[model samples]
Every structure is written in C-alpha cells, then in structure tokens.
Target: MKKFKKLFAATVISLAMLVAAGCGDQPTNEDQGDADNGGGDEVVTETPGDVGDAEITLEFWNGFTGPDGEDIAKIIAEFNNLHEGEIAIRTQTMPWDNFYDQYRTVVTAGEAPDIAIMHLDSIAGYARYDLLTPLDDLAADIGLEDDDFIPEVWDAGVYEGHRYGIPLDVHPLTLFYNVDLLEAAGYSEPPTTYDELVEMSLAVQEATDGDAWGIAMPVFWPSNMIFYSSLMSHGGDSVSEDGLTPLYNTEIGYEALQKMVDLVYEHEVSPSDVQADGEVTLFRQGNSAFHINGIWMIAGFEQQDGLNFAAAPVPTFGDQEAVWAGSHNFVLPKQNDEDPERLEASMKFIQFVSENSLQWAKAGQVPATYSVLESDEFKALEHQYNASQQNFVFPPSTPFYGDAWGPTGPAVDEAMLGQLTPQEALERAAREGEENARDAAEN
Candidate 1:
C-alpha cells in the first residue's frame, strides 16, 4: 500500500504565517448565533436573489475523477440551471493526491476555491492549518440540522467545537458474493457470521475442486480497512480520545489481524500472493466466491458483463457488527477577504446538493442526509442501502491522523505475507504510530 504522507512542516508553517498575516479572527459559535443550541436552531432561509441582485460565480473544487464524477457533473449542471442568472458554480476536478498537494499551495497564495470537498478524517488536519472556514452559521442559515443527517457523519464534520464540513455521502465496505458460485456450493444465502463464512468458504472451495477459490484476500489496498473493521468489531479503537496515542497493539488487535492472515495460511481459502485489486479482478472473472470491497465498486461491477453478484452488509468477523466507512463533505476554504455573498451562495449550493443527493446515490454512495436515506428512491438501491446498514466506524478526528496510521498498512502487509507474526506486526505498528502522533503534536 502507498503510504499517505503528511504535508511538509515548512509548507504548513508558511501557510499558517500567511493566514495570520492576511485573515482576521474567524467567527466563533457564539458569533454565529446560539452557542448552546445545536445545529439549525437559528434558521435564516434565503433565496437565490438574497446574494444581492448581481450574478455571481463560485469556484467549486473536488477530487471525484471516477464514475461518480459524471453523476456530480450532472447535479452541478442542474444546480447551475436552477439559479440561472442569479448564481453559477464553476467546478474544478482532479485526482485526490494532486488535490491535496495543490490545495495548500493555493491557500498559501490566496487562490483557494470558494468551496471544496474534504474527507471526514481530513477535516481536523486542514482546520488545524487554518485553511478552512467554520460553517456553523452557514449550516444554520441553510436549516441543516443534526436530526436530518446520519449521526456518525454529521458529528464527524466538527473539530474543536466548530463545524467545518457538510457531509455529502458515505461509502462503506461490504461483502460481495457470486450468486452462481454460492448456489453451486449448495448455499442459498450469504454468510452472516464468522463460522458461517468459514464453513461456506471451505464448502465452496471443496466443491469447486480447485477450479475457483472461496475468497481472494488482497495484501494491500483495502487490507487495512478490513483490519480496521475487525478491530472495531472486537471493541478496540485505533487511537486514544486525546488523539495523541496509539491503541491497537493489544490481544484484540492480534486476534483481529490473525483472522485475516489465517485466511491465506491456515484456512487456505484464499491465495497467498493476492496483490492490490487482485481480489476485485478475481471476483469479476467468477474466480472467487466472495470478495470484500467498498460500495463504490457497485457501478463498476454492474458494468462487468456476465458477472452474477450481490452485496450484503459486511458479515460479523468479530464480537460485534462494525464496518469501516468514510464520508465526503463540502467545505469552504478560507479566503483572503471573506465575501458574504459567496459564502451565502455556497451554503445555498450545499443545501441544494444535500436535499437532492438521491441523484448522487445513483453512483453507489449512501447519502448522509436522513431524508435521502429514508427515500423510496434510495431504498431502491438495494446493494448500497444494504451496505449502509452496518455500524459504521470512522477514524478519530485529529491533525495528522492518516499519517499516524500509515505504519499500519505495511505491518498488515508483512503479517499477511507471513514475514512476521500478527503480534509482532501490530506491536511494531503501535510503537511507530505513537512516534508519528508525538511528532505531529510537537510540530
């Protein structure tokens, strides 16, 4: 797996200096209206004409360079048409890595877009760098209430008592099974428990006479996400509440990781040398009975001719039901000179997207808004809706949280490859994660 590196210290320092030199004190929760009230307590509804009489164009940026990009472009076109002469949104899309790298450069140079998209785990890091604007007031102005959104995703947008993101959608890891393979193995339904998974997997392997494997366990890509779901299901956390300590090197962690390695070595239901996306290819070609992947693959799977598959909520691999999930959220970048008109327009645009996210859900994502999730249209998306039912687990909100978790992938890789015992790998990861967190805090 590629390690996601942290932004350079020098770049962060320079960006901080630039923000300090040019921007004034950001608004506090109290300044936004009600300090004690939750989101949407003081609603100030506005129309397109509220942003003065003159037409304005807001620059929106994101990293949706996949099949979902087409979905978002259509939505943006509709949004642009609805407002017509009153407001327009100009979008800039790029790869996520390049988006992260260039975002800091643009912010430092006072060329940041009016609005952008950020992942739930990244909100705190960008907020810490003073590159994002708090959206409490804007959220309330658009009548965005906590009760109207998925609780996990809604709460994840806040950092240090201020809201920095408006969640767009959630994509969770789910179980994908070949229907034909299951039936061939005398199984009518997918497994719902660990014992069932093992029994069915072995049954399929034996029935196939080595023609097709039961599962394909990739050594990288989503291997870490699988480990995370297993850890959380065992009632273990990835980090401490303070977000400055590692917490996954315990007996629970060992058990969680060993389960994955055992799929290759002990049970022998999966190949030992599966690489990144190898499992995906195997599942598509009907060479594997089962595969675990994110819901985002639903669209691509549908396009694969003659692949008979269905999705289910991730089966219980531990003591509890938990699955790894992440959300994309709309955020406002800090501008050198705050424009009330653009801010209002951006909030309105966000509200529009949130309300109409059923269109976005067609791209195989679960809309974070409650109404959309409850809609008949969204419920019609059986695979995505099923995957959304799992107890979603998200990373702790902290600056450099991804960096702190970087060592875990290589550790998981080594364990899966049989280079080290699960205990040794997790211990090494925990120690290195602690050092990474400490360095982040000190810097």
Candidate 2:
C-alpha cells in the first residue's frame, strides 16, 4: 500500500511539473502569428483519441487523509488493475484545508488535476470561479442521471444552471449510544423523539450517580451541525433563496438553539463545559449514554476495546425530522486544454467508484448512488442505512454560502457556553453573516 501511494505521489508531482512548464511556454491565441506564413513556431495540439486507442494517465486530487483514504486507495487500485494499460489514475492526497487553499492557485496557473474529489458545499464556490467544468454532458454520455443518485446530493452538484460534480457519498450526523449505559438506565433502545431523549438521558444520569452523564454536549465541532439540523427540524432556513440574507435568527432558530442549550443548562442532562470531541470521548469511555456525531466516527468507535455501542438516526428535536449531511463529489477541473480521451477515462473511473461505493460504505459513509443504497448488501449495514434514511438538510448552494454561514459556529458556541442567550447569539450571527455575505458577493 505504501509503495503504491509513493508511486502515485511521484507521478502526480511529475505531471504537475510538466503541466506547469507547458503553461509557462504555451502562447496565447493573440500571440500566435499566421499559420501559413511560418512566422511563428508551429503549435501542435493532441487531438481527441478513442479511449482504448492509447494509454491515458489522469491526475486525481482529494483530501481523504483518514481511514477513508485507505478505502479509496483500494478502490483506485481496483480501477487501475481493470483498466491496466488503457488508463491510469495518479492521485495526490492532502489535508482538506490545504486542498481548498491550493486548488484555486493551481487551477489559475493551468496546472490543476484531471479529476478532484470535492465536498458538496464547495462545488458552487469553485464553479463560481469558473474553475470546474460542467459535467452534465459528460454525465449523460456515461448514462448517469439524477434519478440514480440521492436527490439532495444530486441537486447539490448544480451551480447556476450547470452540474459541476457527480454525487459520491453522504455522511450524516447520527446518534451513537453506549448499549450498556442505556440498558443500565432501563432503556432497551435509543430514543426516537426529543422528549424521550431528554427522559432517557436524565434516567441514565440518575443511574450512574453523576459518575457518568446522560450526554455530553460539545460547544464546538459538530455543535454547528447539530444546530443546523435542529434549525431545519424547526422549519427554519439557513439563508434566503438568493443566498445573500441570513434567515436563521427567527423564532424557530431560537427554539432550535435554545433546545440544545437547555440540554446542558436547564435539563442538566449534559455537561456544561464539554469541548470539541468531548462528547465522543465521553461516549467511548462509557461516561455518557449518548453522543451525537457524524457517521464517519463509526470506524474509530468500532476499534475501541470493550466498548459496546450502536447507532441510530438522530431523534427529532423539533416539529419535523431533519439531519445535517454532506457529500463527497467527483469533479473535473477546467483544464487549459481539454482532452476528450482523458475526459472520457475520468468519467469512466468516476462511474466505477460510484457503482462500487459499497466499499466506501465500509469506511463509514452512506452511498449517495440510489442503486448502491438500495442493494441488500448496503441495507445490511444498520447504522449507515438508518442514517441515510433521514430527511437530510444540506448547506445552501451559493458561491458565497460559506461566508453567509460563517458566524454560526461561534454563535452556537456562545449559546452553549451560556455567554449569550440563544436569541442574542443568533441575532449577532445573523447580523455578521449578512454583512459577510454582502462583502463576499461584492468581491
């Protein structure tokens, strides 16, 4: 595995260097003189070839730096073996923060990879910059339709009127419960509603005699995600349709955030000062009965010795059921010069991964492809299947959506820390978010 990764990394570096050199020397359309006059150097461009006629190597970039990386590597290996001399995919893995920071720089320099794995929320941002190629025609060529994917994830790939990504997998927030703790509290199953959640949590606290709590509510990390789900459940929208206005500061928003705050303060079911990942630690250590986190944590939780845990969809905490989810998407970066054969190969690779995403599910994600999700093999995975069935709420699709929602985390943190009331925190967040959105739009 290490050898394969090293080889792929070297190939990526070599390809990138060659591309940079080509970009630096290539003449622009205006710089080219009359072709027949022989006044300028002859420009030779590679014409589109049949996919199987010549071996094509594609550069792929992604930020799957955890256990998930290993799973994807396996899938890539399978694809490479199947294509053998026809096509090869070389990958370069980096941290997500670095991926986001460096992609635009590389794309602007005309040295972007042939393929990239993007997050659903990030598709619009890159599309807005014209850094991504529209995938609608390519998708149709490969027989990939919207009906083949989860509706929310499929729609997330579209920016303006064009599709820039192909749905891969969805990872949603779920309820993780320690089986022993729940049983000790006289509960045989996880809670399905807000009242039961609170009731069970309090009972667990009483049973544990304060040594273990009912829940541990963190003030950071997933707190923001939980808030989003709650906001949706309360029938609140994160932003206006135009994506320029913050809409999560109304009465519904207050009810959403206040409910989370109450878990720590009023109900006393959770600790007041749990920091980021504190809830996870508490659940793993059997110090808490319930922990709300993303399904991505399943692999790590399964590795803990002597820990008995199970997962379920997050219980409804408001007027409706909703869960925060995000997806990984396959995207094609806009190239300085496009090659049809390479593009065709890249699409084929994407289709293979999407179809075989059950392997991805083993890495603790819900396959976004409808056929994969409905397969008996996938349905057998209780946790992932259950989480996939939730009414998922995705981030708004807009180039400036990130900026529009930037203040939400700190706002939720303030409320959780009791430094400000839910109403006060959301008001401040909405005011700042709107300003940020306006500034980003202008830029």
Candidate 3:
C-alpha cells in the first residue's frame, strides 16, 4: 500500500540519518571513513564537532504540528551538524490527534523513541502505565538539577518521588483582552481581580447589547485548567494537600463555583444556546470581550486580523493570586532493556534544548529554565508580558489529577446557565468527582 511505502521510506531515511548522526561524533577525520558505512545522502547536524571517538544516537519524537515544530526541527538539525560523530538524533513529527496511540504502540512494542515531548497532565497518565523511563538516576548522573526550573513546572514530573520526565515549558492561564473592544465599551483598563472582572463583564455586555459575550472559556466535564484558575483564585482546593479526597465542596470551593455560575445566570452576560460551545472557538471569532488562555495562543492570534489585544496573567479572586498551569516535558522511553548508545546523545540533546530555550519561547510556551524565564528576551515576548507578575501557579500533580478537571468546570457552567442552582451543582460535582478519583486510584 502507499501508506506502507511512505512509512518504509521514512524509516529508511531515519536510518540514514542515524548513520550520519553517529559520524558527527567521530571527529571530522573519521567522517570520511564513516561515510562509507551507508547511504551518505542523509541530513546532518548544522554544526560540526570534534566527536571523533564518542557517539550517542537518540531517536526523538514529538507532536509539534504548530510553529513550535519548525523551530524545534531547526534546533535538532543544528545539533546534528555540530556534533557529528558524537551524537546523531533521529527526529519524527506526529500529528497531535493520533500521538498517544503511536507513542504507546512504539513504547510497548520495544521500538520506543529515545526521547519525546509530553504535557504535564499526560506524564502522570503514561507513568501510571509504565511506558516511561524514570530520569532520576540519569538526572543525577548528568547533574540535571530541577532547581533551575520553576518549582511547579519541575514538580509536575515528580510523581511518587521518582521523576518520569523533565519539565520543558509552563503554560498558565492569562487574560487576553481586545483593546478596541474595551475602548468601545468605555473601559481602558483590564480586570485585575474577581470584582473587577465582574464589573468589566457587565459593562462590556451592556455596551454590546448581548452582541458579544463578556468572556469565553471552556466549561465542561473534560476541561481541567479553566476551573482550576477560578477555584484557586477564590482560595479553593479541589483535593487535599495529600491528594486524598475532594475538598472543593467546602465554603471557598462552593463560593467560587457559585460566583462563576452567577456570571451567566445572575448577570446575564454568558450565552446559553449551545450544548458545547468551547471558548477557543468564541475567542478566535472575536465573540467575547475577555479570553482566558495561555500565552501559547500568541502565534495563532498574530496571524488573525481585526483585533487589538494584550495578554496578562490570570487575575486573583483572593488576597493571594494563582493561575492554573501545566508543562511540556522531555522524557526518555524505556528501551526494552537495550543499553543503546543513544542515552548520552539524549542527554546532549536535552541539555542543548534546555539551554537554548529562549528561542523556544517565541513559539508561544514558557521555557522551563529559570535563566531564560528571567532573561529580557523571553520576558519581553508579547505573549509572556506578564512573566514577572506574581503568583502564576500551576495546579497540584496527583495520580487522579485529570479527573479533577472537568469535575468542577461544568458544575460552574451549568449553574451559570440556571440549569441547576450553584449549591446543587457543587454537591453533585463533589460526589461525582470523589467517585471518579476513588475509581482511578483503585484501578
């Protein structure tokens, strides 16, 4: 079949890349002899290195499908060209939709990529299934320090005291407002707190005469981070410190969810027509005045038109501020007990990528490195403009973490649509959430 041929060609190209990749480490003197080993028509690293006698070949994979992919590919190419004979990396791009299936098949079948990219939420899922290799010992061997990254981002990879991955980026919720829309609504400033947000929503709604919803964000059973901001903003904790049981049924959680629901039902600012109108759609269409999202949306928004907007860290609902965040981490897949030479190459690639993360941020995600995070280049990224703004906290990492997301999101949504009272929604959500968590933990 055509599909089979395409896969075979890709694999062959990958093998050729592997052969040339190792030559990059063999020193320029040895490259001549190394070239005789296979087809020489392969892509090489961008920079040349004196890796004459050492070689590490690591197979890397990711679902970059966005602008980030282009930038990452360039980085990988440069690493190959520079470190010839020392390290050879074979990189593959997978579509985001079928990424998990492809990932699991390779990992379980003993053909796993040397290293791959994963989201904070997903690491827990894969680690639970034993498809990932722990980076603890390797991390120690290479002096890979987690302290260099934000505590929340780094900690996302630490489940059960054994790190399964290394955090690469932090994507927290931020408020992007259309300046033109704000000006038309008679407001010059963006909301800074819960009260301010409500007022702004009311003003924007009144000014537009229901033509536009004041705000837009996903509120459903599958959404995790959206409610996290609201709950954390209002001093609510869905799970206990120990990740034992659901705790959002308490006053703070109840109050927080109640207020969000009221924003629609009580204030009449949110739409109530569709069964599933996710916020992402509304924001892209300019259907709302305020949008709650991460800076990673910057690249996409830059391509759109008729919008004047800026990003700010998501606001607080309490004395202390926080926003729901997650990370993309670089992880090594278990090689089915094959002590391949690529482990060193994997480390080289990872360290190089981490060190060069400032370039990575331009694609719309925060680099995990503290130095890059503090650097002027990254700080000045139009999307990451609120880097120094306080309390950009991510949610806690728990084995049942994914279950905690939508459990609270829709409770807030339904109550807002007046389909159910706030108290009723919270009560049902708490009961259902605890059951879900318990089921996951038990399984």
The digit string of per-residue lDDT tens for model 2 on 95-185 reads 5545655677788889988999877766776787788999989999999978777776787778889999898887777899989989998
TM-score, candidate 2, is: 0.87
Q: After superposition, how far is residue 312 of candidate 2 from its true place, in Å?
A: 0.4
Candidate 1 lDDT by residue in tens digits, 190-236: 99876788888899988889888989987875677788878877777
Instruction: Give residue 227's error in model 2 in angstroms.
Output: 0.6
Query: Model 1 Cα displacement at 431 (Å)?
Result: 1.3
Tens-place lDDT digits, model 3, residues 217-293 = 34542133445556666766666554446666777766766666665666656665434536656766777888765
Model 1 lDDT-worst window of ten: 8-17
Query: Candidate 1 versus the native: TM-score?
Result: 0.88
- TM-score ranking, best first: 1, 2, 3
In angstroms, how far off is 30's CA in candidate 2? 43
**Alpha-carbon TM-score of each model against the true structure:** 0.88, 0.87, 0.80
TM-score (C-alpha) between model 3 and the true structure: 0.80
Model 1's lDDT to the true fold?
0.75
Candidate 1: RMSD to truth? 9.6
The CA lDDT at 227 in model 3 is: 54
